[model samples]
Target: MVNNNEKDKSSQVTEFSKEAGYYLQKGVHCLNRSQLKKALKYFRKTIETDPHNTYTHYNIAYILSRIDYLKDINETFQEILGTTYNLPEASFLAAIYYSLTGEMDLAEKELEKFLEIAPEGEIMEEAREMLNLLSGEEEIYENLSYIKLSEKYEGVIQTVKEKVKRNLECPFFRVKMLENLYQLDDDLTSNIIFLYGLAENSTIAERVLRHFIKSSWAKEMHKELAMLALRDIGAEEPYEVMMENRIVKVTLKEYFERIPQWEPQWYQVMEKALENIKYNKYHSKTMEGELKEVWNQYIKVAYPEIPPVRDINLWSAALEYLTFKKRGINLNHKEISLKYRVFPEELLEKYKEMGQALSR
Candidate 1:
């Protein structure tokens, strides 16, 4: 009874539906293996192949809900909530999405709706947990049938601890943990690190961060956190940071003192020594910068009580030795002493002073 054109259109629609089903199956398979990127790609194919199938969109949001590290599905959440009423889980996804975006009121409403509609589902407990976290009665993250979030945050915590003990050249996440912590979900901060922040005893933590700031290896946040650490302890009103990017100044109720300054002659003699050993020519800026940082840090600790610049060539030799030691690059003292035409014991004496000052 139908025309050939109508028949062709019907055939094409059926084929597209089959293709969408195939992509949906493949996407779920990848998701079971924790391959989020691949799953998202296949899910996108399903959407593109069957644009009229609104349930496909809901499925995507439902699967991805509360995974805050992933990108937000803002309009998708709104569309599923406003227009699509069949899937109660759309409300669940909306709750997590809104919470991540800092709309606590909207998140609470969505969670309330989700709890009312979906009394029994895979994520019913997760929804309840989220509601509790929003009320400040508990933390937001939950253990689910699929993803174990507690283990994941626990892993990040372990790696961060090892890195803290090993190198002061910290990654950005560590700095984020120390600052702007309220922006993060609760599971991320459930450790001694957050405890220190709460106790306002960032003394040991701040000392380590100060070393990071003074090191040549300091990144941008390292510089900023050093100043903020001062404010946290009721230390100083105005602090000067050596690294100049954009200037920022804030006062916190804490205690701190001004940082120490090194004599310019120390750097000049160190550069001359670096040239003597052909160190500057090989790694010119690195050799100079590292020596300057080590010299200044020792000065910071032992300032006013620091020794006078006598027989600066001997001190230059010691400065070069200390810089290498700070980097965990061992240089033979006898070898370094000879290179600077200084006696080994005299260089050792100066080097010992530098090391002892930092240990304080």
Candidate 2:
């Protein structure tokens, strides 16, 4: 039922829409790569090409909000909301902007609307917390260090206590939580020692041994476990405090014969030893020489394509490159890469190629 002029206009509109879609895809790709300036440019082009596109407006608003382009953010967000788009994400962002600007009433209203629209949204928990905070139902201590520590450690303490009270036999879980707590505050030496005593698993014991070797509390409360752990892990150093405990010495000797004597595979051993050394931990030094020898053997066997290099620096690079190629893990040293005039993007592409080849 269309005339020739109308048909030509329709064809032109279709072509423009296709071009706009291409620009939109480019914008999204740039955004994903964190190229904020390029993304904004492409998005603005998309707006020029297709002024009625709500998604383009939303994305531009999001970028502007992140960059604190406060003058334009509200207008852009309002444009998105004015459209027929059901944008709960926009509402959430608007709420955050309002909160930042000290417009509490507006922020509360936007958050409430966001909840009503998307009750099971990704930011629901954060929204609820913010609402509680805004309503003064929950206290947010700004300057109290003790209150902050109490808040941080309370959940861990409560979970462990509840498990203990219920007579739940999840030693692994208890020890894992204790390990996290220990990492948070090494001053919780007594608490960790108590939990370690109750758990006594080999994994937990090793973690405790690595972290608390110098702790007086650990030596006083967990001497037996520490001695047994060190012995199991083939530690050469003797603990003076543990040696003074007659029961610990006797127990250590009893368990010494039962510990496994097998070694892990060369690659795994090399990785673990290197990681420990990287962290300035000396627990893996006994295997360093053997690990270097194994690395040479591995390079000779697995990476025949790479030329042989005898220098430790070149050897390290070869090892890191081959490991990355084989396992898709980025073991390449950033400083070394800079020395060699290589870039992270180049390494990423190499890794991607390796992954694709493996998939084939």
Candidate 3:
């Protein structure tokens, strides 16, 4: 026969289970309400007894991120990564954490692995979008690193040539490697002209020139190459390619006498390049608070009549903010609220001043 005391004890245990379950549900509700602190307390209590609950682990991670507890966030992510429990949730959260902490390689690996396991993950759409953005950023960094490495090592061209022969096509590495070569070797100018003109795979060369023209050294190299290939070789067709592709700035026009054979098409491309440069120059110039003061007066005079539009102020604010503040925009748009409305000249000037101060 069951003893009355043992029955009472069993009842007490059942009541405790009910209490714990209630608290766990309430904790989740609190998190949904953005009551981070209240949610944290209940979650902590539930996790203390039910340590293996995957939902509890995921929720703690979310709340930790909200409160900006980076160390805790990373630790929680490590835990999520370890779990054989709830893979889709684990991977999705793990990817986010890895990305936030700038462990992009790890994040990418986790995301890819996640897709393999759960191709249609619960957050698959969001995961794909985030993956696209993160991978793009990784590609940029990888490309930059490759450029730097190629610049550092003289043997990079041979290495790339070998890779190309092996049918290894890393667009990022190839494009940057070509750029480094163009900067270091004048002989590469002919190669550059040929690559841009006659090669079937001209996209890499095109990208190289796009990145090259941004730097003074590369821009000068491009000009030199243009003069050599266009004047000495009398390759009017290639010159047309340069101009048509906007391979270099329009300022190179002064170097040539009669335009290339395809003068009409060439001039048209130059016109487009000049227009883009002009538009960008206007934004940089009119944004009176941009950190680059060298071009400030030139731009101001160049577009004297152009109004100080909201875009101009925004561009100025963005440049100064990025250059000086080094702030990251991970938080909600409303929380970091940058006003995008139009402002009068007086207001614009005030904002510019504010930007300048923030820049300093």
Candidate 4:
């Protein structure tokens, strides 16, 4: 015969457990969908309801680690460590985080603790491999170079190339090829672009340009070249906003001047140039000859002693130097002088005067 008070407490505990399980399931569902914020909210509610839930703690730490929220991640892992409950899995995950961040000493400590407490399972094998690598007992690099590794994956490369050649317009195929080649070698990655350039498929070029702009791995030079290729084909207007934000006026001036006055692409080039010039008032002179005259008149009015240069290239380069300096960039006047065929002393003097006026 159990007491009534004990029965009531047992019922309340069971209800709370069920509610915690429900929230945990919801959190896992949101996490799988990559709704990290929502998942974190649900996980927090679960923690509030069931303070002893190790799985929820692990999930919270995992999400925090993935997002690189290091402060919160460290606190959460520390909380897990302080718990009396055995969570060897948490130690394993901490080891991985430390290893990725190059904290080899902390990683080794965590890995050793994980191996000491973790139950025998598939993770044991993984833990052993990590320990061996950390201890320098195993040579992690059997091949050493991507070149040698690429030979083993030649079939994968050929398949991607075949798919790309079969349907040059298929962005999926091109993106897949780029991904595969990028993993293999830098030369292979460049080869994909070279092949596309030779084909002169404007559509393919546009797709590749957008892909490069969005990719984290693509260098600034790659993005610039992609934009230049698009500009050459007059497909640049679609990316006008991105171009306006990223490209320097000197580069934009060259792009607009080099645009061919042909039948199909002329309007696109003119429209893109006009739109960009309107948005970036500083580059109005670079885009339109009439605007350049107006700018010279304004400069003559403001500074009567400093006469404008007759050479458009030198003027443009000077403007670029001024803009660069205004943005706190350290300018190499000698390099600019050699590149633009302007006297370094003259360029430096103009830059100093421009800096003074700008300061005022």
Worst 10 residues of 4 by lDDT: 147-156
Misplaced by over 4 Å in model 2 are 1-71, 76-87, 142-325, 328-360
Instruction: Write one digit per residue (lDDT tens) for candidate 3, span 240-334.
Output: 22433344433334423222112233223223322333333233322222233312332333333333433443443333333233323222222
TM-score for each predicted model, relative to the true structure: 0.30, 0.26, 0.23, 0.28
* lDDT order of candidates, top first: 1, 4, 2, 3
Candidate 1 TM-score to native? 0.30
Which of the numbered candidates is closest to the native, going by highest lDDT? Answer: 1
Q: Model 4 residue 107 lDDT?
A: 74
In model 1, how large is the Cα lDDT of residue 47? 61
lDDT tens per residue, model 1, 1-360: 999888767766766776676567556555545556666667667766775543354345434443334444564344334434456766765665565445778878988998898788657776776677677684423221222222222112224234433332344534544553332433332222322222233455555434434444444333433444444444445443334343334332111123332366665676666666464223444454566557667776787797788787888888888877887778888988887889999999999988899899
What is the Å distance of residue 360 in model 4 from its true position? Answer: 62
Using lDDT as the yardstick, the better of models 2 and 3 is 2
Q: State which candidate has the highest TM-score.
A: 1
lDDT of 2 by residue, 141-205 (tens): 42222222212211222243343323324565545545543454433443344333333344544
Q: Please write out the lDDT profile of model 4 over residues 24-127, one tens digit for every residue.
A: 65565555455556666666666677654433443344344454442365654454344423456556656655654457788788879877876574367666
- Extract clashing residue pairs from model 1: 233-254, 233-255, 234-253, 234-254, 234-255, 235-254, 235-255, 235-256
Cα-lDDT of candidate 3: 0.42
**Candidate 2 positional error at 257, Å:** 59
